[model samples]
Target: MRDYFIRRLLLIIPTLLGATIAVFFITRIVPGGPLEARMRQAMAMASERSMKDAGGSLSEEQKEQLAAYYGFDKPFFPAYLIWLGAAPQEVEKQFIKFEEGQNEAKVTLKTLLPRAQWTATNAFKVSEATVDRKGALTGPDVVGWKTKAEPEKQRVTVFRTKFNGLLQGNLGVSTRYNDRVWAMIKERMPVSIFYGLITFILTYAVCIPLGVIKAIKHRTVLDNATSVVIFIGYAVPGFVLGSLLVVYLAARMGWFPTGGFVSDNFSQLSVSGKVWDLTHHAILPLICYMVGGFAFMTMLVKNNLMDNLAADYVRTAIAKGATFRGAVLGHALRNSLIPLATTLGQIVTVFVGGSILIERIFDIDGFGMLSFQAVTDRDYPLVMGVLVVSAFLTLLGNILSDFFVALADPRIRFR
Candidate 1:
């Protein structure tokens, strides 16, 4: 088992590397980029300034400089490498010299060499050139230059990659929120975990016992009635149930807060008061979150238990002087729980993913809402950060599920 677990853990490295490579290239190929978004914002601001006063737009040179500043001028693959912190940082310096003669000005562009070897190429069109007071060309001519560089062993920084910051527990800054991605996620994670814990606890606590009872009762009225109720809960979506609960329980009866995870002055309240306030605000959302899971879990437990009860082992146990109740409990119960045990890992992952529509409806600022906003705003850093975390959890969860399945069933062994 130890060797099996170690092998499974080791497999995660290649899986994560492949996932990151796919995500990085796919995100880069998307139409709009941060640089373009920044340019649009700049243009809008420029337009607003023009309306207020005699304003001007950014020049071509200014645009090029902005692109370079943001590292947009580099090829996507190279930029990706730099972002990953696997490539060396390069800085270029250029100087243009002009000499005035009788009719036209002589133009020469020179690029300073860096530690890395580079080839420089320049293109200029001298449509009409006039010499300035400093003997520099001042005309409508265009000049463009590009340099290609190969880093030396001493020049390249081997430790830099886009994930370097992530490795150090930093999620980088949000381009949209203007704050640290880690800070934003940290602020919202509690809301998700709180409701997730409550939902998980309530669902299992209620459903497991109910499922066992339903299985024991089999085709009786009690089983049918419970099935009907579970189906109703399953049929209703969490968002729909949330809205209904808000209308009937919150608006009509005024038994709970309509939405939100806590009161504005919750910190000022006594400990018990704070707890009451939290539970009051959470009731509707918690109910909504749990209802969907309850029906499915109950049905799963019922079916698994019922099948195990009818198995040959239970019949043999009953024939060997075991009471019906003892046969079900001692011979069938443990095996019945194996299926549910496999799902434990997935439940853990759901805590982090949260429910987007549910959070939005309740006005809860959680990971789900943050992810939604990040995607819509194209905040790549935050989006990637969330994705990486989610992917890691999902992969880890599957591995954990395997361990759980092995634990639950002694017959199933890991080599």
Candidate 2:
């Protein structure tokens, strides 16, 4: 079992690589990218200028600057490698001038706060130039010589590269929001986690017991009534249910808050007040989030338990002077839970976020909403950043499910 898990863990690297490579390449090929959007904006501005005087298009230098700014200047593979932190990311070019009178020349170079070497080329001779966090130049004295004898103002461009990507814990910056991608993801993660955790706990907590009761009381009025309700919930989507709840419960009856994860002054509340505030805000959304899963999980538990109860071992246990509760709880219930245990790991992925439409309907700022906005705005960095976290979690969840299955069923063993 240990060796099997080790192999699964190692396989995640290549699996994730293959998945991300497809998505990374697709982002590059897609239209309406950052560069195109910038160009459209520039053209719109130029059109406005045309009304005032004459139309002006972006120059080649301006286009190249835009391309470089969005990291679109590199080829597909190099850009992907840089994003994975396997290749160095190019920083903005800095220039230094060697004047005739100045004895010592100092130039401030922009860096990602890491120690890096800046090489000067074209009409300048620089040896081993390095910059610290404070942007101070170090190393041997910088010397410059021109082709002409007379000393002249010689401008030399410095090239610098930094390894900033997934390996470096940098997800790049969002082209749309102009913010760090990981920062945005971190900011919205909590809201989704709160909803997801609550939904998971409540779904299992309520569904499992209810399923047991239904299975035991099969063909009774209690079972028939609950089945109708469960099917209704299964048929209705979470977002649609959320809308109905908001309208009827919030808009008409004024029972619950309309939408949002919390109140405006949530931070200012006392401890118990904060708890009440969260509960108050959570009621409607939580109901919507749990409804769909509640139905399916309940039915799954009921059917599995029923099947196990009818098995030969359960009948034998009951015939051997064991109580009905013992036969159900000790023997049948354990076997019935194998399917649920196998799927338990998959539920972990929801810690990142909930349904996008449900989030939009509730006006909650969560990871799901961030992902939707990133894709809609064509924010490549943010999209890829979200994908990286999500894909990793999903893959890990699958392995976890397998481990859980092994634990639930003693007969199962990994080779």
Candidate 3:
């Protein structure tokens, strides 16, 4: 386990390095800027005018300045290396620092200036109360007070982040939303995470057993009917299913929310009532993700189980007086699941890392929503940041998938 962990950790370096390179390259292919972002929006006329105006005479200097401000100044490989190696990994540290012996350097005003006396250690205290003596940052008071400091103690943190640099729960700034990416992700994540997870659970619970049952029953009415149903689920696309569910279950039947994360008046409701409202809103999306989601997994499990059932060990178990149920659920289920269960580790990130269309359809504000907007708006840096995140997720998923292989079949070892 120790060796495996070390190997995985080592792998993350190149994984992130590659992600940085890919993200940087991909961003350059996209053009436009902050004004262009607003103007290109089909929904906003003023922004479109601004974008068109900017596009006509965006000077080389202006383009370069924009690129530099957003960290697109360097050649792709250099930028990737710099971002991976030197970018500061925290939000509160989003400040510029002067180099040692470089006398005239300064932190720019546009940067997230520390509110008076914020420190790496004392950042959390910033929201409420005065700074302790030991932690006070000495800046000129009242808009120009100048206090000299020890050159050695004068480092300011920067805000650029990468995968290997990701702190636990570090959702970076939302380049599109004009809010902390973490906050945005938090608000929408609960909706999708809760909905997707519940849906996943319901899906596997229902489908796995049903698949097993159908396989055992073998072309009886139960088996035939279940197969037909599973085929239908497999046939229908997720978005179509989601839309239909919204119309029928939520809009027509009025059993669940039609769209959106919660009712507008949820906050005004009592705590229990708010919870009830959230649950009601969640039901439709959850059902949507689940109803169409299960067939692939179910088919994978049923086939794997049936294949195992014909294995020598399975026949041997039957020969030893094991009942069909015991052979199916106890021995075969455990063995087959290692292969199938690996998928969970991969899918676990989908709620957090992807789901752009689902977020759009539901109008839920999240990383997915930001990513989608970034593409349409041509906000390159923001789009690259999201791409980097997606790459990390894919890497992490691959790592767990490998680990699952090891756990499922002990003969396989992690190097």
Best by lDDT: 2
Model 1: clashing residue pairs?
83-162, 84-161, 84-162, 85-160, 85-161, 85-162, 86-160, 86-161
Better of 1 and 2 by lDDT: 2
Off by over 4 Å in 3: 1-5, 35-68, 71-175, 350-354
TM-scores for all predictions: 0.77, 0.85, 0.71
Question: What TM-score would candidate 1 get against the native?
Answer: 0.77
Provide the overall lDDT of each model, using Cα atoms, as 2-decimal numbers.
Answer: 0.72, 0.82, 0.61
Write the number of the candidate with greater lDDT, choosing between 2 and 3: 2
Clashing pairs in 2: none
Off by over 4 Å in 1: 48-56, 64-71, 88-164
Best by TM-score: 2
Cα RMSD of all models vs. native, in order, equals: 10.4, 6.9, 8.9
Provide the clashing-pair count of each candidate structure: 8, 0, 3
Better of 1 and 3 by lDDT: 1
Cα displacement (Å) at residue 380, model 1: 0.6
